[model samples]
Target: MIFLRYILLPIVPIYYLVTWLRNILYDFGIKKSVSYNFPVICVGNLSVGGTGKTPMIEYLINLLKDDYLVATLSRGYKRKTEGFQLANIDATAESIGDEPYQFYNKFKNDILVAVDANRNNGIKQLQLIDKQPDVILLDDAFQHRKVKAGFNILLTTYNNPYFKDIVLPTGNLREPRSGAKRANIIIVTKCPKDLSEAEKNSILKQVDPETNQHVFFSSISYSNSVISSEATKAVEDLEDFTLVTGIANASPLVHFLGDKGLKFEHLNFKDHHDFSKQDIIELNKRALIVTTEKDFMRLKQYESLKDKLFYLPINVVINDEVRINKLIKDFLKIKL
Candidate 1:
């Protein structure tokens, strides 16, 4: 893999130039972007995936759902269906992507969730609803420059900050690091629980945020129990099991489970991987199987594994959350 990355170095400049030109066109208004009157906050990343975007979106939903009519708009990646579609009782992971489907499963009664590759069209369709959302949360739509969000929250993992990386083909970045300037808030996700002040200062120096951007750090907090459709079990009570993960990065989760002195065989797959029938046949053999909440969304559809399959829930533990919550609320207040 390292050799392949080095071999692909020549293609990096071409990728960078293309993305740079696109951003320039948008920046100069050569390509117009639609802006709405109501609040539309975007949570996205400069790098590919695994920056805890879903958790961050859920955090915002939790923060504002009680006080405001919250709705989420996503591209509905990997879904069988296409175009603007609203989440309802018939929704499934295969219908609206895993993350958005997870959001609907959790917040169906409290918020509206919809998916469309064309974010501008999605927003317009959402506005046409009888009960319009007071605020719309754009999930993973930063590079979708066609629609301008009121607040942009860009996330990067602490271990692999975008500043230290180059563009795609050689590195993980989707655009130039300068593209981070568009974000109103920059969050360093997957930080250590005991991250020191000096370390934070070092990262801030590398980040070099502009005058308008606010930087924050967050760590993943794992739940004490693993949940399944049938029952919930305490993490400490789990025996030998199979750990399946189809996420961009599962290192943090592997480390978390290791720290708990648990024993399990890990079956790591590609991010957003679609499980084959044979995959289910193999997984059903295990006495107990553990997976991430997102993966559980897809796996839960199979009837054979319902009794043994369990997923560990995780949330982002933002440092100085009170301040971050205030910042989000303040932004919404201004937009309203």
Candidate 2:
């Protein structure tokens, strides 16, 4: 696959030109973008996937849910259903997608979670609700120019920043590196726990943020315990188990477990991969199974796997937490 992308490298210029022009059209107002009175914060990335979007979206939810009525809008990637859908009792990973379903299960009472491929129409449907949200967070719509987000919180992985990458087929980026200029805030996600000031400055130099953009660095804070519907167990207490993951990147989780001296065999799959019957049969052979919160949403559907299947939940731990919080809070306050 790595060789395949290089083989397709000639197309990069074509892909680059096309995406560039589309963004230019939106940027220069040749294409009209809808704006809302309430703050619309978009959390997205230039890369194709695994830049910690879900964790960042959850971070925003936790940050704003206490003070404002917050609603999240996402494209509901890989779900079976179509059109706008507000999470309800019947919601499932198959219905509204894994990440949104996770949001509904965890923070249903605190925030409203909705999914629609058509974000403009999604916002319209959300507006029609009895108590419209005071703020709407678009999960992954930096490229979705139909609705102009008031504050764009763009993310790039610390390991593979967009500036260091090329556009799709040849590399991971979904758009040209110049597209990052659209961001109000640029975050280097999945960084080292003890990221130093010198290192931050070095990364910032490479990212080359625009004059108005504020750059932040963050790492994943994994939970100490693994959760399942039946029970929970201390991560350290787990014996030999299979690490079943269907996420874009599993290296961080693998490294985390390794650092803890946990022993396990990994059964990796593509991101958002739906399990086949044979896949389940292979997974069921293991006595204990651990997965990500997103994969757990789909994997637990098998009754035979429910008792033993567990998932580790994680949060984005931003560096310089106080300053970052103040900056965002001030932006929201002034915007409102």
Best prediction by TM-score: 1
| TM-score for candidate 1 | 0.99
Residue-level lDDT tens digits of model 2 in 1-336: 888988999999999999999988988999999988778999999998799999988888888899999999999999999999999989999999999998888899999999999999999999999999989999999999999998898999988889889998798888899989989989999999888899999998998877888899999999999999889999999889999999999999999998999999999899999899999999889999999999998887899998889999999898877887787788788778
- For candidate 1, give the lDDT of residue 216: 98
C-alpha RMSD for every candidate: 0.7, 1.1
Model 2 lDDT at residue 218: 95
Which segments of model 2 are wrong by more than 4 Å?
A: none
Candidate 1 local lDDT, 59-169, one digit each (tens): 999999999999999998899999999999999999999999999999999999999999999999999999999999999998999999989999999999999999988
Estimate every model's Cα lDDT from 0 to 1. 0.95, 0.92
- Model 1 gets an lDDT of 0.95
TM-score, every prediction? 0.99, 0.98
Candidate 1 lDDT trough over 10 residues, lowest sum: 314-323
Worst 10 residues of 2 by lDDT: 319-328
